[model samples]
Target: MALQDRPNEKPEASPADLVSSLAEASLALARAASEGEAYAALDMAAHRLAALSSGRVSICELGMSPNGRALILWQSSRGGLSIGEDSLFAEWYTRASRMGGEMTPARGHIWYGLLSADTLNDETGIRVAIFLKFDEMKEELAAHAYGLADIAAAVALRIRKQKAAALERRRFDGMYETTRAWLELGADIVWEASPEGILRCRRILNRRGDISRLVDGMDLRSLRIGGGGQSLLDFLEQQGSVRHMRAHLPEDAQGRMSTGETLYVSATARRSPDEDAPYIGTFTAIGRDAPSDGTRETATMLLQMRGARIREEQHRREAEAMLQGLRLLLSQDSSREKMSRLVGLVGECIGSSDACVAEKGLDGKVRILVPQQKSPGPGAAAALDFIAAGAPRGVVGVYDIDAAEGRNIADAFGLEGCQVAALALPLRGDAAFLVCVTRRAEGFAPADLDFADRFALLLRQALLLREEQSHLAQTAKMAALGQMSASIAHELRQPLNTISLAVQNLEFLLESLDFDREAAAKKTKRVLAQVERASDVIDRMRRFGRKSVGEHASLVLRNVIENVEAIMHHVLLRAGVRLEVEISPDVTAYADQLQLEQVIGNLLQNAVDAISGIGAKHERAEGLIKITASPSPDEKGMTVLRVEDSGPGFRPEIAERVLEPFFTTKSAEHGTGLGLAICDAIIRESGGRIEIGNHAAGGFVQIVLPRQPA
Candidate 1:
């Protein structure tokens, strides 16, 4: 995938021919004792082909350009004629195919085509050609080639083995040696499985890879993950491996495994292959506060020297360069803030003043459209409008400014200007809309287009994360504030109730000494109840604010809601609000009890506030508040709780902002503005959501809670 190494453009050799050639060559090298032996065998093989061709056949070398054709080099056994090197194989075939006689091999079994002319040097004025043809007996020549290949393979294997032996001798000093030894000791990679049988790895080895005592011949580089004899039995079972599954013989039952679809996983579970335990070296990977901090610091001090510092700086530069390369990878970035920074740079990256994006609409049209650019040329402007008007393939695609002609600019495309070129990039698949890169003067370059396309992808994915992070931060803050406010409210209730009661007692103390002690005691009890009610209100708020989660179970939701109402009845009465409860029978849901309680309390409190804010304006028509709960008909398993107050209805515009944290119509003293937001979060966590708006009764806020299957 390097820029220069574009595999897409690389012409693939015929699979049959490639396999045949590689197999034959591998066999030869494997059989040879050394490189010299392999070369000698190749020369002898080439000589045999020459004798078989009657000295007319040739071959091609790999990666030799003008090297576009099949590469098969030649070795003449006997011929007065010679072929020039400048001729390519494709040209030879083309010419050969056109010729009257077909390509026929001579006396040998080897089958090969002539290397033909590809170029004529302009300066030298020299033309290259291959006039050779396949002789009658080609099979003999093939046999000769195959024989040489076999010898070559032997030579290659011997040399490779010798080198590997030298390196394998040092295995005792390295982890690989440790792994190798363990595998030899009849070990299997150990892993732990969940009760559900999901196996997470504790180690990997023994099940696959080279377990043979002959260390010199093993493939060390491929000894891990897909290779290195890494046998993923389960991974293979789940995700079929095209490599070894079909290639290896005898279908090693010992290597039976499974795989994961999205994440490639090893299938076989670890077992005691023998009585002995698997040997694992006991060396700890130190954490940040390791006891060897002193030595580490001393090492760090040493690292600060010129050699280490220079290396560190070099590494830092490399990382910075990589960041620059990935500057447009807004999607891969984990942070929305980082994504936002990338967003700011997006315009500059695309050479546009303003660049906003739109996502694909559900109707397969373009919506949520964004135009990025302050003032673009007519083309850019038209481009933006065209895409904005028409649907795009996805969140991102090519938007030719030429398409938008003779259209009213500003009125049509939200805002428009001179448009030169524009490109639309869809974010997050085609889920949303396209980002229009409206540029002025210059059109987008190829690199610019490619960059914008990828950037748009990254940007879209990042947006979702950004949105989630933003929501979490807001939720956490609101939860904290809600708890504090609730606690403070609870603490103040008793004192207020005490003061109210003392005033009542004083008012009566001035009366007759026997001023109906029984009635007086009842009045004092009511005052204490109100104080307790205040304490209850505080407790409810604290419940709403608490970070701890309650155990979940299916419960009769009606009871939970009734309990909440009972707890807050005093507070509701003090505000002069009438509470109404309407819950259908047989209503049940799986949810955390305390959390549901908090959810119900928040809704009730919101109703009281809305009523108080509106009802206080006039003494009359202070309406009733209704709370209802029932199973959702459309959703197979869901419960809906609706709390409605009969006060002035909510304005449609504020409805959307109602659930946002720190958004309240009332002054700071009366409300923390965290109530609805916390309610939304708590509900969502319990698998639900809350909505605010005008009710049929007068005003309403609906809370939707998800119910787990009963």
Candidate 2:
């Protein structure tokens, strides 16, 4: 990093050579890396010059004295020279007394010569003093005194330049370093912008660097919103000259504006003699402060308020988005898969890149439901084991997992080593939902955790809904079995009777001496066919009887209707009615398969009973029930399912009541009245609606369900 040392050289002989040597010495001093090296070069030059003149040369600093004629040797080539302070003055007087123009001291006698400058005086006070013996060419040496003066002057100049450069460097470094320190201690931004709002320079002095660019262009609107209190634009426009103006700057998060920080700033429009220049300003940040005075207290309070407002705004937005996502989750059936994606979405809303949901089971096992990513390494097992132990049960909160207490949980989040914050939602009993989000430790403030708490509330609500739906689904399955019991018995009896008769016939054939092979074969085949029919009946009964697993998926209305018709065929036949199903191939919807079938079957059963009850009162009229499904009238994202029966229509006043729970018109033994009500709930919860009315020839029930999205 420093220049290489100058080439070393030997002393010269002639006066001309000595002058050249002095020039070369000056160049070597210039090449010196530091002041110490330069001094060494000067000493070397003195020694070389002493050798050339057959005299010892020394550099001296002239000192202030009473007589003003003293020399102090700073560096010497001759070590033992003792020249008295008055000796030089005595010599000068002797020369004057003799009246000689010039004279060198005699040989073998010690005398001193000074390197005197005619033009440049040494501001540094150093002079080159040469101690020598008298020589014949004394005037010659004195005649060329200017050359020695020039050499001394060159050394002085080099030293002076080096000192000046070092001083300038120190000054520059000190000023900028002090400025930087002050900025870090609470100076937010140093910015300069054009009067027309174009930014010329912008610097952020805080860890929150992303927001710096928000004010780069210095737009009046951004300033007004980002800085809340006084109208920044109006102030800037009205100011003839502004300095250290206190103003409000509001925070902007993805275009959602709210109150931000109060900043002390100097904004000035530079003015020359001829024209006004662009505005230059700085927004000084106010950091954490403990004030000893009222003024300081007020300033600190303002800064705290600024930070609080920004956090409150950000948390509100995140909470709202989180609640919306949870609503969407609960709107459908909540599943582990959907919940996983939802956790990630929630993380993004709250400015976290990593998030997950975990469940603690009764068997001391922790299940990560959402973000079922790769398992953690062995290093994380200890933390995960603690969670599985259910130590945090019922201790619900938004916690900084990176802190002392939360470290274990944070460590278990896997992969990303960012700061973690967790929200735990306790379900019934020992089961709990633990949701975690991760970011830099400072990224989340205490107030920011409020959003996580809101998220926990949403998760709790979703869990409650899921439990309620499960209970409702089980209750619906029970109600369906009670309603269809009699029909199921009647439906299975015929096949059972056929199997018994076929077995008796086969036995009779086998008892014959020469068994009628063809007859026995026919009877065996008949019996096998009957057994198969019985199995089918049992399978359909089991499908409708078991609990519904509330999972939503795409299903074609035509296919679902065919399955329902097959299951309910005997029920319709025993009711003395004909069931006709007409469904378009393209009528599809997103719904639970078993639940949808149950709804349609309930509707049809209600229709069958209504037709039978009506027939008992009216003269024997042919009973016909028609179930139809097609796309909605206007082709919205919906499928309309209609069930119409040739029965006494609903009493006009009771049309709406028929859809209400426990409002069936049928006899108590035959109806629980939950059929239509359950169907209505299913339709509405699927983001659709249900309608009940009297059509041209029957009581009609119409269902509109959300169609599968393209």
> Which candidate should be chosen as best, given TM-score against the real structure?
2
Per-residue error for 594 in candidate 2, Å, reads 0.4
Runs in model 2 deviating more than 4 A are 1-391, 394-447, 614-620
Cα lDDT of model 1 by residue, 1-710, tens digit: 10011111112455455445445544564566654655544443343344345444332222122322323343332222333433233333333322211232221223334222211111111122223344454454545444443333334345655755556445423644444343333233333333233333354342333222211122212222344344334333344332212112122421532221011222232344551322211111122343312132233333444355455544544343334434423211224223434555555555655444444433444333232222233344444446555645433344444444423322334433334333444334344333433545455655555555555555565556534543554465454445345445655766786768666775776586667777766767777776776676667655545543224567787888777776666667677888878886677777668667766676666667666663234333665888888887644566777788877776766665666788888775666666676666555544455556675657777765656622
Query: For candidate 2, lDDT tens digit of each residue in 603-694?
Result: 88778877887323544378899888888774367788889988887775576466667776666677667767777666554545566677
Mark the 10 consecutive residues where model 2 has the least summed lDDT.
93-102
Give the per-residue Cα lDDT of candidate 1 at 42.
49
| TM-score of candidate 1 to 2 decimals | 0.29
Worst ten in a row by lDDT for model 1? 1-10
